[model samples]
Target: MKHGALLRKISVVGVSAACCIALVGCGGTNYGYTGGVAATVNGAEIQEDTITKYIQDFRTSSDLTSDDDWGNWMKENSFDPATVRDQVIDYYVENELKKQACDEKGITVEQSQVDDEINNMKANYDSDDAWKQALSSAGLTEDQYRESVEAGLLDEALEDAVAGDAATADDSKVLDMLNTYYTMFNGAKKSSHILFASGDTEKAQEVLDQINAGTLDFAEAAKQYSTDTASAADGGNVGWDAINSFVTDYTDALDGLSVGQVSGLVTSDYGIHIIKCTDEFTCDGKATSLSAYPQEFVDYISNIVKDQSKSTAYSNWFNDYKAQADIQNNDMPENVPYNLDMTKYDNSDSSSDNSDGSSNGASADTNADASATEDSSESSNEKSSDSENSGQ
Candidate 1:
């Protein structure tokens, strides 16, 4: 199982951008706050100061030097300053519950593990200054970052301990899953297609006619006329993806075809497609047997089964533990700094800037583990500068 899955509720930002700074002070013993408490998880106080610190650190790391920057960042991320305090508190509360559960199971993270995680994060940058800058950008001190890593490690250990037998599957289970999918999808099919622009039915029909007449080769027709450039370059091969992975129309057209059979002109949201079934895995309409499938396909299905087993195990364990835990959230304190008055910041100038402030597409509420590695060079900033640019 992925360690990130264990702490999804606690991670409030992407790793490359914020390094998951929200996780600070989430593990170890209680802070023993003398100030007002934000929450109480099984009689352990989550201090109001802790919530304030999280917001302050996030603000500092995001380089929100002015009210305008803060306001714009909030706007871009759809953050409601009024409820951010409650969100932070809730995340900490969940983290505390996980930590407590780990403790109950005698799960402990060694300091060396925390150090190694930090060292791995440091390796992602070139110099000490760059490392420090990343920490500051994440709004984390080295010590606080260590705490986050420790919490993540503890959560991972807890998952393994609790999941136990549910994390594995026998060969019988794998075959059963494959049989179900095969019966539902009428066995798997692989296809290649020649695509045309939407509404270009005349052009699509002409290409189909040429291929049907035996004058034009299917692969050559795809390479010459298909608009889906990525698949077209490879003779329009969509490969052996699961049936559900394709659009409804594509899958419907593919389902009716036998091996080496060419489909009539099919239309979907992606535009017109002339599909050819390259391969199939049906054992003469018998869904009970896998003898007809290649060993490679069986192996693929086995891995998927194992992954699903692990995920289901983790989910079941966490859900049960959380449901039984004594989690109590106190009301929000009146004087918390999270409630920012947007009226003070001039929105007219910064409203048009769609950048989420960070170079990566790190939002104030996204999942990232402490040990997560990401290439800083290739960020969402490079993919598309304008948030409105949703590429086809």
Candidate 2:
């Protein structure tokens, strides 16, 4: 559960990045998706294709294609149409999931119970003004943030109802499950590959034609042919990678290419595999890593363990709850990655009052930076500069 590991767990969607940016209100922007599948939960349509679009956008936004098992890495961490759901479900599900679980146990959350929770959360903010500022950064109004806090209480209540003895629960188990669940996740492997889900090499071949024709890009080709689904939308972006970091097919095919070199279509179990040597790096970090993105790696590892150790009871309780729950992912889409577009909400802004009458993560910044410069001229100029520097 290191931040390095969580790096893969992160949605690389361009739209997701936009949303992350949205939370910052750094010259807030409003971005939207022209198309993508809407999200549906229990037969209720959530957002029509908005989920898929967000998933795709988030995947494309991140520059994190670096891994030894790039193909599997992308597959495991494929974007979830959960930008909205992803953000909102924690509150909703934890609320309902907890409510239903607690109702069975006849346990009620008293106003006093919730009051303490709110006060505790407020304390974490240092002061009233500071708390409001933090909420604003997250695009939440005070009321909205409080509702989310209440939902946390509900989630806790439900966990107690179902799992029993909130102490000594299963945080490690959950983190372990998270670590083991996907190749693209914390399991640790990254690769570059081509996808042939088109059932034939025709599409992959077309990519080759483009590369050969000097028009189609290798990273873009990987994005186009990568049947890995999740990373495809990102044009096969692999981040912080090294040699032998990918599948055998990838490493073998890549032997002839130099750094930044893209190869012809090479076939793999997933589909056609293409290798791009974006970089050559060495891994020299310690075994320790953050449970999630190590935006502050040392601090997280240093403090998290002691905090969890003190909450062993809660962790144990969670373990039992998850064990008994009849959780299942039914009706998984064949093109699961297609169900989400990470960028659907990118650079788009929306402001609404939550039940508590507070605004939630709304920004109005529009497409100021969307038009990233073309790679050719910018890349060529940079390369020329590098060569000049080298010669001098």
RMSD of each: 13.4, 23.9
Task: Report lDDT (CA) for all predictions.
Answer: 0.63, 0.41
The sequence of per-residue lDDT tens digits that candidate 1 reaches over residues 1-392 is 12232123234533222434645444434334324777778888777777766666667666664566667666666665656666677677767878788778788988888787778667657788877776664455677667767777787787778775665657776667666656533467778888888889999999899998999999898889988776777787766534225667888888899899999988887788899989875543344555556564566565556546655687777778778877776676555554566654445555526577433223564443232112111122223211111101
Kindly report which residue stretches of model 2 are placed more than 4 angstroms away from their true locations once superposed. Answer: 1-95, 120-129, 157-392
Q: For model 1, what is the alpha-carbon lDDT of residue 314?
A: 76
Please give the TM-score that candidate 1 achieves against the real structure: 0.50
Candidate 1, residue 10: lDDT? 30
Best by lDDT: 1
Give candidate 1 misplaced runs (Cα > 4 Å).
Answer: 1-19, 25-35, 63-79, 115-137, 170-304, 341-392
Q: Against the true structure, what is each candidate's TM-score? A: 0.50, 0.29
lDDT of 2 by residue, 59-171 (tens): 34433222212222223334333333354322222233444555567876677876775575565454778766655554446554455455455655654554443323244
lDDT of 1: 0.63
